[model samples]
Target: MAFVILKDLAYQYPSSTGLVLENISLQIQEGEFVSIIGPNGAGKSTLCYALAGFVPHFFKGEISGEVEVDGRKSSESTLDEWALNVGLAFQNPFNQISGAKYTVFEEIAFGLENIGVPRDEMKKRVEDAMSLTGISDLADRSPYSLSGGQQQRVALTSILVMRPRLLVLDEPTSQMDPVGTREVFGVVRKMAEEGMTVVMVEHKVEWIANFADRVIALKDGQILIEGKPNEVLTSDLLIENGFGISRYTSAAREARKRGLWKKEKLPVTLDEAVEGFKS
Candidate 1:
């Protein structure tokens, strides 16, 4: 069954702007790892909010059409109810964390606790979340004391404790260094492997290309293309639509220009490029 569904979704802010999303339609199955990639203002984040039921609930926007999560309409649901099924992690980790007084364990437990999870189960979930994210060693430390990557992991663990059916991450690794990026992606990959539905809005094409089951490219608030990672990542349509191509694909194109590689099929990863050269 489709876990999340959007049919002709449209949203417009109350202030002075036009529709941020227009006639958008999508369906995400349970345990699918999907990534939405586009340039700024392509309505990627807006779509995320729309799917999470934050568009009209928190943003005071005019929304039309239907958005259903597990067969419940998003427009009629409360944010609290939506939180139980969809966990969202924003671009900025600082905004997601609570006050300085909350320790890492307390912070992770806060969500499950609010939902009235039993104390023993809450504790187990918190410990499991921390362990899965590799933050169990820092459970006693203050959230403020951790490094950027560590803090991001804490934020992720907090959401993981909720055990939502769907996870929506908006550029979770945008601010981190290379090591931090890898750490967070590792957590995401682990979650995906464990059968959690993940829908992320990210510009890091190179990292997500190998892991994503499907890629959706948005341009001017519309889906420009959607397909497997290799097909979508190597398309000239993505580049023409202003969605950045993978570095390896660009490198392969350059090699073709220099007469070093002449395969008809474009390579999306370095390994594929190497194989193409060998063939």
Candidate 2:
């Protein structure tokens, strides 16, 4: 059975007249890592919200059709209840930080404390999550004292400590430097390997190619393409629609026209580009 099922899902914000999403249907199996790619205003962020149960519940929007996660219908469950099954981490980690907390550790534990988790278990969960995200050393640092990347790690650790079955990420590494971006993506990949489902919306085509099990491209709130990472990321439709692809893919496409690249399929990463050109 699919862990996340969205059938004919449509949503429009309270302030907006038109739907942000329309007839969006998809099924994500347990432990799958799905990456969503789209141009600006294509409703990628909105789709992440729907997966995280913030669409109709938290956003108070007009929603139609079904959104079910781990067999629980989003409309049928309260926001509080949905939190146990889905976690959301977005682009602005600074906004996610609770200024009331004195230290990073406290901030990470805030969610668990509010949900009435036992103290002993809460501490253990936070420790594990920090370690998983490679932020254990920053536990005692002030949340405001950290750099943008470190703060993003803390934001993600805060959500991860909840042990939600499904994690929804919308450009979680957008603010991070290259090193920090890799560190955060490492944690995300590890979580999927350990059986947590993840839906990530990212513009980093190379990272998506490396980690995502499947890729879905969205256009105007509807699915434009859905398939293996290699297929969707390198498809001509994305290029025509003004979606960004890997630099390697772009260069390879140009080279192919000049009869410089003999490969039938374009490469999405540097390694593939080198091999494709050599062969």
Candidate 3:
């Protein structure tokens, strides 16, 4: 059985006229790294909320269909219990901050403390997660004093320390620079390889192509396309739907049109572009 499952899922926010997410059905295997790409209002964030058990739990909206993880349905599980196996990091780092913690280390360990994790083990987990995201040096610094990118890293580290079975990240790297974005993607990829199921909503198509096992493009509260990274990232349907794609893919598409590129498949990454152009 798939580790995560969503069947005919649709959700409408409180007092909202229409569904924010419509007719969404997906299955993710254990240890799979899936990336979701769409423009603003594509329901990507809402999808993350559903997977994290916040849709009908905290949002208290009309929802239909099933959200299942590890054979347990979200409808049958309490938010507290669902949160044990699923972790969600919001798009805005400030929204994720607890505001009660003074230092970054404490912010990352707050969840563990709330859950009654042993002090010695909590410290180790916090340290390890901070190191993983290259934030060990910022442990003593105030989260409020850090830059947007740094705060984002801290938010991600906080969730990582909990070691949730399913990790749902909404634009986790939006505030990061190119190098930082690469590092974050690398960390998530490594986690997925180590048996963590990850579903990330991101606009960085190049990184998604390089790291994600699959890509799903959503539009108008529904999935428009989903497949291997290369296929989905280079699909013309994405361009037609106003979805962002990799520059390499855009260039390769133009090159193909001009008869300068002979490859049937377009490039989605720099390495692929270089090789395609060379051949």
Best by lDDT: 3
Task: Specify the highest-TM-score model's number.
Answer: 3
| TM-score for each predicted model, relative to the true structure | 0.94, 0.97, 0.99
lDDT of 1 by residue, 1-279 (tens): 698888998888888378888888889888889999999998888888887778889997798989898889988889888888999886678888987445899989988878899999999999988887777899889999988777878887888888888899988878777776777777777788888889988888877776788999888888888989888889999877777887789888889899987898888877888898887
- In model 2, the runs with Cα more than 4 Å from the true position are none
**Of the pair 1 and 3, which is ahead by TM-score?**
3
Clashing pairs in 2: none
What is the C-alpha lDDT profile of model 2 across 92-196, one tens digit per residue? 888789899999999999999999999999999999989988889999999999988889889999999988899999898888888777777788888899999
Clashes per model (N, Cα, C within 3 A):
0, 0, 0
lDDT of each: 0.84, 0.92, 0.97
| Preferred candidate (lDDT higher): 1 or 2 | 2
lDDT of 3 by residue, 165-272 (tens): 999999999999999999999999999999999999999999999999999999999999999999999999999999998889998889988998999999999999
| C-alpha lDDT (0 to 100) for residue 248 of candidate 1 | 80
